[model samples]
Target chain A: MQSKISISNLDFYYGKTQALFDISMEIPERQVVAFIGPSGCGKSTFLRTLNRMNDTIPIARAEGVVKIDGENIYAPGTDVVALRRKVGMVFQKSNPFPKSIFENVAYGIRINGLHKNKADLQERVEKALRDAALLNEVKDRLNSSAFGLSGGQQQRLCIARALAVQPEVILMDEPASALDPIATQKIEELVVELKKQYSIVIVTHNMQQASRVSDKTAFFMLGKLIEFNPTQKMFTNPDERLTEDYITGRFG
Target chain B: MENRLLDQQLDLLRDKILLLGGTTEAALHRAMQSLTERDSELAKKVMDEDRIIDQMELEIDRLSVEILALQKPAAHDLRFVISVAKITPILERIADHAGSIAEAAIKINQEPQLKNYIDMPLMAEIAAEMLRTALDAFTSEDAAVSREVILRDQKIDECYHRVFDELIRIMINNPQAATCAAHLMFVAKHLERIGDYVKDICELNVYLREAAFIKHSPNQ
Candidate 1:
């Protein structure tokens, strides 16, 4: 239960409006933590703050501390690119590079110059695909366009791209919301499998998905972190009444 | 975010479970009355009414499975459905015990009248009261009342031990009275078993209210 990331007294703002209240929690290493709440509840926003993904917005401001592996990621002069490489992200929609499946996964390694040679790059791409649970499905079609794969396969390809960088942590924002049930199952299984090697933080609207894949769940509401508890306890007998109502579909 | 559809289905499930509880309670009462009054016809009626209890159990099972499969209830709803599903079979089994008591009553009535049925009637009353209180606690989701009902089972157990010793003495004093004494002993045993079943129901009620299993852990 060693913590990989720690956030203390963190507050986020967009322009003049505050988007997150003082939030603090420990994200344990090699465990999947799920963020769940209603829309506009700042779950996704808080997720982006982990890797400073919110820095892309000119009006965004973050206060307090977000430390990864004992190093404060929000400190001045922190290497943003290196931090992102350590914490890769997958979006809701599968945004493949419009390149071949192999190249799409190879893009991150190539940019980071992680491979020793062409053969090493090839090995890295295949390994990423294998780790993503997509190698068997796409092995014969690695040279084909990324768009040619099914929606679920394309989502896994995006995950493979994220994996190619060998991130210590993976942040997913509703990674399976657009896929069918079968596809969603694959992504859910992949999330469970990936937790053995990577600390994963996922923001999902689906409560069952959070219950299924996460070791711990953080419930957010109105830009405030209401409760963080073991996923089994959260779903069965949550301590906070707000957490109970939200999970039980009684929130207004 | 009020889920009216889920709420309505849950209401139906609650109504069905309560109906089954009421029916089982009635069966236990009628069976005990048949035994005390030496009414063979009433005993037969209790036996015949058992099929209705069986049918109700099946219906409740069907509804519980439907809610689990289609609604996919979580949190309190999930626990409530699971509690009802578990309690249905326990209630049905209690009714079966009552039916067995009614059978024993008919057999004992065929011979000469047994001694005044004092402790047996008291044991039956205590069992009926425990069941009624357990059902009320279930309806109100009252964990305190469930805990209280569980403690009441001890009273039934005490009465059972008393009846067992008294019946054994009677059988020893008059060897010819062994047949009727043996049947009365079975009636006492049925009431004791009913007490245990009521305890199980109370445990489920505690779980439904508090989300804790107090079955094996008495301190809980």
Candidate 2:
């Protein structure tokens, strides 16, 4: 399988306090790769570096090569906006704007000028909603406020908004952590379905969710990548003692 | 972090699986001892105790399912639970084979005695030893011992083939001993199957230790 993103000897820092060690991994194209560890283990920090999402933080800085399709994204003169457009992100909290459902889905398309006309924007919004598995739930109420929907629906809206720009990769940081089990199941199923077209990188504290949604799993600890293997192999028999200890609830 | 409750539950499950293995192993010993010692009453006792083994299997399966559903265990814990769930049925089948051997013993004791047991008793010894070692490997989580038990299964198979040829020779030479020899052959077959079940248990022990199955693998 072709790699969608590759990180080699990557390190991240926030004002001299290192958040990540020499992390190196290759996320295969159109496969779900999960980053799993405890809070502050650098799973999320490593994930944000993929699209340069850490650039906004005042003290955040990164070194080493983060390549997408053999092009170093951290090289000089690289457009951060275009990188983010190609590698969209969803967050732990479902932060849907106080706009209508259609507008929420259409927000990215309009900002990027991705559509040629109003009809084109409408089609793209519907397709994104369908891809997010939320079209039928709110098709009749596209004009309704995004907040009117439940937390899970709002999260899917955020996912649909990410999908609107046709990103080649989607990075989800605990996308369903705030939702209930059934809602979480829907999002997990949607993620599995979306992998057919887009590569997915998920950071999750829920080990079961990572096992359920990801084809490949990376375990992290103390700012280091401890183990990377197929999800089944990682869950069944992780190589490192720390990875086994953490996954078995023995220690973290 | 410690999930004390899950850890305790898993420990309890391990103990229960050991108990099941012990019960089945004892039943096989009693069954074979009855056959070899010409004790029909002891054979009847082995037949009666099969129900308890069945019940133990069901209880183990129930606990395994509960742990899987409630704890969502991963890594070694997951492998252990799944291995127990699989090993339970294999042990139950071994107990059933023991019961069959007991029945054959009862039937053979009613008939006129054939030539004294030779390879059949040896086969029973090997099968019982395999079960004991396989259970030991399970408790110790020793793949090395498991690999030994897997290789030991072939010894029992060789003993079974010898018992078959000797029984056929006895039947052909002495026409009156044909029914007795047939019953002995069935007993040998039951013991052979018990060996197979023990090998299955050994394979599960290997899986629990290594998280890789060696069954039907040419490389192993």
Candidate 3:
């Protein structure tokens, strides 16, 4: 039960406004940890801090240590590009490249130089697609545009793209929010399967989805980590009153 | 605030369960009275009224299922619906015990009286009061009262044991009193079982209020 990622007294700010306060947690290796909270609760912001994705925002400021495998990711001279490669992200909206389906998944492989020959790259793409559970649906349509797939398929394609880089951890920010119920079920099932090889942190507004897919759940409120426990315990009987109230639909 | 309709439906479920509790309690009380007074007419009436209790249980079960299927209630709501579903069968079974007591009373009334019924009536009173208090605890969401009701079950058990020993002694001393004493023993047994069902309801009450199971007996 090794910790894949650990955050200690992590704080984040957007310009002068503090967005997260003293947030600390450890995500266990090969387990799906869900971050659940209302909108503007800093769950997504904290997720971005894991891979230093916040660096893209000019005014975003992050403080404290985020360690993946005991290495301080926030330390000076740490390669953010390589860090992002180790910790990949899927977004709320599925943003697939407008290229062919095969190319969309192959883009990460080619850029990372993860494979040797043409056949090697093709094998990597297929493996990533199969890991994402989208290979059979798009196998015959590999040459078709990524946009031609359904919203759910496109999301899976983005997941395959993330998988191609061989990330040890996958961060999903409301990965199934845009899809319908059946599609969402597919993504949830995929998350369960993916946990075998990769540590996963998912930011989800849907409580049922978190209960369905996550091993551990963290309840955040107003930029603060409120309660974190096993998903079953947190959902059935949370320690904090606020967490119980929120999960029970008494308040947000 | 999230589900106003679900809230309303839960309130309705509470009312319905309370009503069922009231009816079953009355049946127990009347059955006990019939036994002690040798009122065959009242005993027959109590036996007949069991059908109403059965129908009420089915209705409560249907309502619980509707809430489960339509609302997908979670947390306390989920516990409440589940408690209702569980408690209805318990109430139905309690009513069945009352009916059995009434049947024993009718048979006992046909024969010559063995002894004056004192402990059996006391046990029935204690069990009936436990049922009433457990239902009250359910409506008030009062775990304290549920704990008290669970604790009170021992009183009924003691009363049953006493009645059982007395009947056994009476049958041993006078062989002619065997049939009547046996019927009295069954009446005491039925009352004891009613007390156990009331304990079940109290356990469910604790589950509803605290979301925790209280496994220890009243004395324990």
Candidate 4:
């Protein structure tokens, strides 16, 4: 199901670093919203807060509400684990387990206790791989080790693993940062394809990559969201001078 | 230069400029060729080709304007399109100077080759080099090299005055070569003007560095 996540007065701190201010925005369902900025502008920090991935950090503290599908996942009795199952994540590095590729995908579903039978599990693994456009590459070698796959292949596997859980939201924290150009292109193609079935939020440092892949782009600076708009306007004619200066290789 | 896409587009535009530049360069070439050989037909070709280059300039301009309006480009994309818009017509102006050289060559073709040949071809060569490098600046986005082109225009002007002085001596020395020498002086002036335009583009890149502000003609 397509789900919209709304952030309201979201404030975050990494051991008093104060990574984000009273940031507020609405990310439309089924559209890729790319969080962009300099290295430490809270783009990735804000993305992590969407799925409550920040809670795992020992000193990371947050305030305000981030609601997905009108439900405040941070509210009392809100299951963090269940919320995570719904909002899967892919990291900058492809962290596939040193197991057969089939087990790598089945691991998420089995751990979630969401499937009833072996056939159902198999269908999910195959479907997610197919959706990621990686099924063809590893179809004949389902039992092959995921670690043996290339950087791009492993990243696509991580995405497929996220999809296998049937999550409505997938948060990618610099998913293509570790890959080469051709691999980056494949991941970008996958992100565009994934937009049809899920709401994806990606944190990227590459300005052109954001322009190429995202539907909407949000620029962050000095711990504040400077501007957020359609990708075309954000990259071409951004309203804020600070945003324009930053994107044009000015004082960043 | 390694990127075929950027290089190919730059080359197409470069070829367009040179094709346009060639007409002017040819005008200067044939003007001198005519002065040296007394070929009136070659002089006429330069004048006719100038009008044709002007028409091609207009067509190229319309096409470039259409791309900017329709494509709705972003930062680097915007930079590229805007630079093309500025670069194409500078090439046309250089062609205009070539046409003037043809006009001068026709007059000189009927008379004897004058001592004014000393600085005229040298000035044309300087102008052609400036046009060539200014285009190289556009193709590479090399602001530093563009500045070099901008600086070279002064040298072209200096050469123009030297030609003006030399031709004045020819006009006084031989009354028959006076009209032809006067025509060559204007051709040198036109070449110098083309150099000024290439420098205008060096600064034009600065204006377009942020956003494209298309200048509207008086009526439209």
Candidate 5:
């Protein structure tokens, strides 16, 4: 299994305060790796660093080497736009473009000029929707408003928008945290399906969701990477006691 | 530490399992006492008390399922529930073997004594001791104690072999003592089977403590 992204001696800070300390891990190719911990543990912050999502924070500073496909993403003169195109992100809330379902997915393809013509753009939009497992549900309503769909459908629409760019890696920050059980199940199933084409890194507070959807799990505590192992081993018999305590709901 | 609602439920589950263990251990002891004393009424009492053991197994099964479904325990808590679910049946089977021994005792008491019942009583004592220690290890979650309990099974096996040969020789030599010798042989076999069940319980104990399966492993 080849590693899609590798981080070593990664340290992150918000202004004068350090949030992550000497963090290092590998994200395997085409596999889902989940980051789990309590709130304020820096799992979400660490996830944002993968694609420079934290670059939006004026006071944030990252110092480390983040390599994707053997190229350093943090090197000087690196194209942030190209890096973000290869590493797409879906947020906790579904932020559709207030456009039709078809246009929501076509937005990324149109801006990136990924298609040859109008017909090619339509084909790419349909393919992205199909890959996100939302085509069958909203095929007839492709021209309808994105806000008209259910919460789960909108989240999948965001996923389709990310998929439209054909990223090699996808980062999701609590993707299904706001949804109900049935809707959460749909997202989880979609995640398992999406791993065949793109490596996924998801930061979730839901322990069972991580166990259900991820191939590997990384436990974070107070900005430190406590343990990283196969999901089955982590859930059944984790190597660290802190991981066990957190997963079993015994942590303070 | 903050007290969680799950901790109370887990405590109740632990109490139920310990109660079941105590009841099964007592059943094994009383069944052996009836056999050695030639007390037919005590043997009947032991046989009748098996229903309680059956009901306890059902209760444990229901509680385990509830915990798994509602609470959704993970890691050590999950392993503990699984161990209890597996161990309930083994304990019930041990009690069932004790009932079988009680039935044999009733049949053998109808005739003259066979060879003073020496080795059979010793085997029963060892099996009962192993059951007690296995239950203790389970309650304490001690893997080392579980390993020691597993090693004690060999003593019961050796005693069973000796009782088997002695009973066979007595049956061949004294034709009138054939029925009594046969019943005593079955009692010995029942004790041996109980030993194996105790070993299984100890294996589960080790799993509950260490989160590792030692059963059928060459190193264990």
Candidate 6:
């Protein structure tokens, strides 16, 4: 199977300080990947590099090729806006627009000019909502303001909004941190369903949630990727004592 | 941290298990002493304390459940909690066997003693040593020391067979000892069972450390 994201000897620096240390990993296509570690270990920094989201802030420099489908995303003359269209992100906060629900989802497709007719936009919006599993709950009230939905429903709206672009890779940065347990489970389920069509990388503080939702698990510490292996092996018999200690509640 | 609370509860349970171990070891010695001196009063005291041992077993079980529920333990904690749970049954069986020894002492008090009990005293001494060493392994969390207990049980087993041979000889040499000899035979059997209890503790100790259940008998 082709790797959806292949990062090799990837290094990142902010001014004089480096944040990532010689990190190399492959996220296979259509599989859910989870990055777990103590805070400020650069999993989220690496996630931003996938879509060139870090380029917006000056002095955040990246070296080494971050390939998507065997194409180097960092190569000169690469259209970052087009690359970002294929790689969408959901943040820790839901951040649903103050607009109505239908418009919130419809905004992405309309701005991208992916559809010409109003009917086409409506069909695409409904399909994205359906794919997010938010269609049934929001089907009767698609015009209601998105802020009126509960935190979980609103997050699902954010996910739907990201999916509306029909991106091939979904970047979730602690997507369920602000949600309750039931809503976290819903997001976990959505990630599982979404992995059938999109390659996903989720950075989470939750160890058991990473064990539950991802096909592969990565452990990072002090700006280094300690281990990347199947989730079961990562949880049960991790190679590094530090990784095992962290998962077993012996340390952070 | 709540993990500190979990560790404290486990330590408390360990203390109680050792306390029960000390109690049973003392009771076994007293039961043997009663048999030696033909003291019916001391035998009754050993027998009555079996109820206290039974109550201790239930209390250990209750605390074990609380640790399992509240700690949501994994790995070694899970293994330690499970070992404690399994170790109770062995401890209870040891207490019951000691109680049976006391009953024998009581019964012999009502009748003439058998051939002066040359091997029964030796067997009880060896059996109590095995129990004491097994509890030592549990308290120190030493697998090597526990393995030593395994080796010593072999000596206890040898003593069991020797005691059996001597009892059979006594029964044949003097038919007048037939009733008293039967009780002595059970006493020998109970001492053999105490050896098995030590073996049980060794197995639980290995599991507590490794989360791996190692069977002593390969054929089984």
Query: In what order do the candidates fall by TM-score, top score first?
Result: 1, 2, 5, 3, 6, 4
Candidate order by lDDT, decreasing, is 1, 5, 2, 3, 6, 4
Output the worst ten-in-a-row residue range by lDDT, candidate 6 chain B: B211-220
DockQ: which is higher, 1 or 2?
2
Candidate 4: fraction of native contacts reproduced: 0.18
Number of the top DockQ candidate? 2
Please give the TM-score that candidate 2 achieves against the real structure: 0.97
Q: For candidate 1, lDDT tens digit of each residue in B1-220?
A: 7877778889998999899899999999999888888898999999999999999999989988998898778788888999999999999999999999999989988888876864999999999999999999999999998988888999999999999999999989988988999999999999999999999999999898888999999595
lDDT of 5 at A62: 97
List the candidate 3 regions with Cα displacement exceeding 4 Å: B216-220
Residue lDDT tens for model 4, A128-220: 899988999999999999988999999999999999988999999999998999999999999998998889999998877899999999999
Q: Which lDDT value does model 3 have at A74? A: 93
For model 3, how does the per-residue alpha-carbon lDDT over A84-177 read when each residue is reduced to its tens digit? 9999999999999979999999998888889999999999999999999999999999999999999999999999999999999999999999
The better candidate by TM-score, 2 or 3, is 2
DockQ of 1: 0.76
Q: Identify the candidate with maximal TM-score.
A: 1
Interface C-alpha RMSD per candidate, 1 decimal? 1.0, 1.3, 2.3, 7.1, 1.7, 3.7
Model 4, runs deviating above 4 Å: A1-3, B1-83, B86-220
Q: Using Cα atoms with residue i matched to residue i, what is each candidate's TM-score against the true structure? A: 0.98, 0.97, 0.93, 0.62, 0.97, 0.73
Best lDDT goes to which candidate?
A: 1
List, residue by residue over B1-220, the lDDT tens digit for candidate 6. Answer: 1356767887898888888888888888888888889988999999999999999999999999988787655545666788889998788888898889889988877778666686677778878887888888887778777777777888877888887888788789988887788888898899898888878888788666544566655631
Predicted candidate 2 versus true structure: per-residue lDDT over B1-220, tens digit per residue: 6889899999999999899999999999999888888899999999999999999998999999999999989889999999999999999999999999899999888887665686887888889889999999899999998888889989988988898998889889988888889988888888888888888888888889998988998877
C-alpha lDDT score of every prediction, in listed order:
0.94, 0.93, 0.91, 0.79, 0.93, 0.86
DockQ of each: 0.76, 0.81, 0.45, 0.11, 0.63, 0.13
lDDT digits (tens) for residues B149-210 of candidate 3:
88888899899889988998988998988998998998888888888888888888888877
Between 1 and 4, whose DockQ is larger?
1
- Residue B105 accuracy (lDDT) in model 4: 71
